[model samples]
Target: MATTDDSFNGLTEYCDECELDTLHEVSVQIRTESTKKENAQFSREPYRVSECQRCGHRTSQRMNNA
Candidate 1:
């Protein structure tokens, strides 16, 4: 089961558009993966986002549950 604190590894939208208050299903992907090295590194995926179908506005923000 997924928990509130569970770090989901997929796309997540957490904000609404100011123009239309429409929710956008932003696309998110794992730009990079963790290595077995001492420290882990993270890379943000490109912002090749799409607009909300209902409002025609871009997503306000993108996030991961993790």
Candidate 2:
């Protein structure tokens, strides 16, 4: 079997519903938002969203802003 750095290689994460660490499918996404100022400063943020392969629970968090 071949493996890369992604979660496809049987990566496991904590799932709230499952209540135990389980395999999770992870994905990357960008979130766009503007600061609450007169001239709003728009920004694009990256995040890793993961879903438990067994229970369908989601765990998401913003990644380091690059």
Candidate 3:
């Protein structure tokens, strides 16, 4: 399972409509990718959906683990 941290919790993003980095609500969707290897486990990726609390502006970003 993917856990949300303070950095990517959607409150730090800049909202164009609000013209600032304001509070936002974040929703995460987990996707599993199947591997062809015989003993390989599936890889999990999370897509973050964020909506501005003030203006309801929405944006999405895929999380990268590196």
Model 1 CA deviation exceeding 4 Å by range: 1-18, 29-45, 48-50, 59-66
- The global C-alpha lDDT for each of the candidates, from Candidate 1 onward, is 0.42, 0.70, 0.71
Candidate 2 deviant stretches above 4 angstroms = 1-10, 35-41
Q: Top model by TM-score, which number?
A: 2
The digit string of per-residue lDDT tens for model 3 on 1-66 reads 223446554455678899987778888888665565653455767888888777899977778775
TM-score of 1: 0.27
Clashing residue pairs for model 3? none
Best by lDDT, which number?
3
Tell how far residue 9 is off in model 3, in angstroms. 9.6
What ranges in model 3 sit over 4 Å off? Answer: 1-12, 31-45
- Model 1, 1-66: lDDT tens digits are 111322343233332554433334445444443454544454443344545546566642234545
Query: How do the candidates rank by TM-score, highest first?
Result: 2, 3, 1
Residue 2 displacement (Å), model 2: 18
| Per-structure clash totals for the candidates | 0, 0, 0
